[model samples]
Target chain A: MSKKPVKGEYIETDTGNKVSRRSQIIGTTNIILGGKTVIQAEVIIRGDLLRTYTSSNPGEKQGNPVAVAIGRYCFFSRGCELRPPGKLYKGQFSHYPLKIADHVFIGPGSIIEAALIGSHVNIGANCVVGKFAIIKDYVRILDGTVVPPNMVIPSFSIVAGRPGRVVGEIAEGEVDGMDLREVYREVRN
Target chain B: MSNKRQSMMPPAPKPPTSLSSSIVIAEHASLTGTKLIMIGSNTVIHPRAKLNSAYAPITIGSTCIISERSQIGILKEPEDEEEAEPVVIENGVVVEVGAIVEARRVGEGSVIEVNARIGKGAVLGKHCKIGPLCEVAEGEVLPDFTVIFGNGMRRIDNSGVEDLKMKMVARQVEVLRKLIPSNIAKFQ
Candidate 1:
């Protein structure tokens, strides 16, 4: 058996991101990542599941081919998956792009198919953020909670339970703990 | 992606799987143990599936189907005090896509659905059905024919569909065994 890769093991990019070699990222041309993102081992990003349709509006992002777009300082833990949500829109089945904003941390073994995840969100381990779900800024999703598809989560709220219900709000002081710079500094072999 | 027959680390020199002659592991499936991971006859492991036995040995029985991206034999947490034992999966088990299993024992004909997690040291009894996205807590003991679903609701199952499913899985194994080359020579 292979020994566990150490906590300090990672590949440092020119843009300051830390990515593990053991991560399974398919079709890199279709995935966009902002600087300083941390992608841990065993994380699966399905960038190949792109939109099959050509949009009429040139200004719409649906015309572009990006499947998973992540912002700065985001952290994805081991065994998590990022797959674009698909649906039949305007009589055509297409997989939409997954857009995640800054300072978001997704925990281990979570499967994310959300349409939008706003800034400073913290999702705990083993949670399932369903397809087309909209999670607003500063939201915290508890472990093992399954957020149903297309649920619009309000900002700064803590969500738990199956098909997720808002339980509490995050205090203003707690947002500072979402910074990933300290973790970025230590994630090097 | 599957690792090459030669491992990168010097501490683990042997090829990482012990497959029976009829077993079919896809080219992209990854096994991370030489002496600790064993597969029985007529088992089918799909692409992108991972089996890691670093902290413990793993024994998978005959006629098992481990679907794509499903994980087996995850290590126990650091805070866990008990010594890790082998993860044992009995005959005719089906672990569907993307599920993570680190259980101590998975009994015969159990069906673990998509994205479900079986935590460390948990024991699943015969013919149990763990529904999609369900979470079985660490060290929990589930009885035979138990069905877990719908926001953690559970009950003893009396459904008699396992025999038909077993025959179907056997047919699948027969087909896959012919398609995927028996790569046991390189591993053993």
Candidate 2:
């Protein structure tokens, strides 16, 4: 078993703003925070760890922000991580931002970096949305479920698991879909 | 001759883990000597945090964020099973809101998502992501920068990404920090 890393010890690149131990901020990988977005601590922007997208919007930031575009009246709980779109690369490191549509609810400890999330999405607590995964509007990701990279979740669906399979389609304003264990298979190589 | 004996005294009992000012315990939490907590500078423990370790202590690195409503505890040994070891979360790691990590070691810069449960002696690599509400079984090792979200699961060891009985979610581009789990097996 390996140990966890220290927070203050690492250094960030010259580009983005500093991420304090526990604070909220907006950054590229494509972040569009709604005018009234209220985010709490343990929140993170999943910028391109690989620098995959082109962030050359000439200050406008063409690449994805960690959050693409948050709508008004959005509340992000603690421990949320957002991944934006960036330049895609075969191997070379590029950068992109996350694209979040309007009116999304990101629960605590949720990770949505480098993905395309549509409007009115309610991501449950501790749900992990992979890079480049497209989630349409009204999608509810259950707690502790995993969304694979580059996968597309049709709108109004509920997903849960190690590799989260779509348990069922969520009705309008509906929560609670399928059993996490039944939908997702245990992660095996 | 009896007066000289006054100089001899037994060592003091350790302060309860919650009382150690060296470590920051969040509000609405209780800690005791049964738990050991080692945290780096500027690490914040949110309200309603609870760490109970009869088997081992909870260690966190500097500038890390342990979110609210989180329960970090040691797992009891199963019937006929030897006592398990302590849970160690290294520097720069983020234990997201409502996440539960009960393991030997979680690597630096790794993110354990909300409501995630890590089993005994599981080692996660640096910059890795253990997605929300996921459960990683014991004796699993994750390499650096690997993303374990969305059913992406793999195991690690001395040799690189060889296929195991376990399924790997995905290994990212970055390298995780190299660290060995602190040996707490003898404490029991």
Candidate 3:
């Protein structure tokens, strides 16, 4: 079951994105990983679930088909899954793109199906951010939290529980700790 | 240590019978064990999705989406039973990421959400939705349109939207067929 290790554990991209060799990332053409992102081992990013429904607006320029878009300095821990959420819209079943901004730290074993995750967010281990959920900037989702589908979590909030509820707010002093630059640097082969 | 771990692992998966020509089974998907496994057309089996039929056979119908890390089939035979029951996943079922399904039968259009566990011998009816991280006890039977959510809360969804949901599953499968590169030949 074991293959010979040809090189280092991670393949660092030209843009400085460090992707683990053991990561199961499908449909690489449809995934956009901004520079300085670290994808740990056993992570499954489903970039194959691209949007199929075409927009009716003729004048609007067609954007590149992307299933998942991640910004810089993001850390996706081991065993986490990033899936684009799908639903029936106007009689067409289509998957929407999942977007994540910079400095986002997603803990291990979390399954994220959220539509948008803003900057400086920290999601704890075993959390499930449901489909179409919008998480704004500076949010901290506690461990084992199950954020329900379509739930919107505003900025500076701490969310927890099964059907995750906003339990508290993050203070201004605590927000600085959410930066993932240090975390990214420490993840060595 | 690595050699010892590899020795403990199960034998290489035997190829399943009756895999349709149009099914999209990824090259990395693990089809394991030593029993008959049948998959219908347009079903998308993502990478790392496991179909373990060592204890019993597994039958998956058309347009089903078995996501990554999800395990289908029973882990072991029951102590009291002489033979293990086969797992039957009906048409249009979506077993999401990391879910472990050991169900006796999962009816059509059911959605087993991420990390959900359907215990051994559980029977899920048509259009049933098991929420993320939820657990269905072994041998439990759920009725049609049952929505099992937060902390084991139960509700019947007679919302008249079952047709739309099924259509969505079909469309998702259609899109997946074009996106996921299938290695059906390897599995066959």
TM-score for each of the candidates: 0.59, 0.46, 0.92
Q: Best-fitting candidate, measured by lDDT? A: 3
Please give the ranking of all candidate structures by TM-score, highest first, separated by commas.
3, 1, 2
Residue B113 accuracy (lDDT) in model 1? 76
On lDDT, the stronger of 1 and 2 is: 1
The fraction of reference interface contacts (C-alpha pairs within 8 A across chains A and B) present in each candidate is: 0.05, 0.23, 0.95
What overall lDDT goes with each candidate model? 0.83, 0.56, 0.91
Instruction: Give the lowest summed-lDDT range of ten residues in model 3 chain B.
Output: B1-10
Q: Give a tens-digit lDDT track for model 1, residues A1-189.
A: 668654555778898888888888876889898989999998988776676657797887644579899999899999898878766566555678999999899999888989999998999998888779999999999998889779999998999987689999899998888777787666666
Score chain B of candidate 2 by TM-score.
0.65
True contacts kept of 2: 0.23
lDDT of 3 at B17: 72
Interface RMSD of each: 9.4, 8.4, 1.2
Count of backbone clashes, every candidate in sequence: 0, 75, 0
Q: Report RMSD (Å) for each prediction in the order shown.
A: 8.4, 15.3, 3.6
Best by DockQ: 3
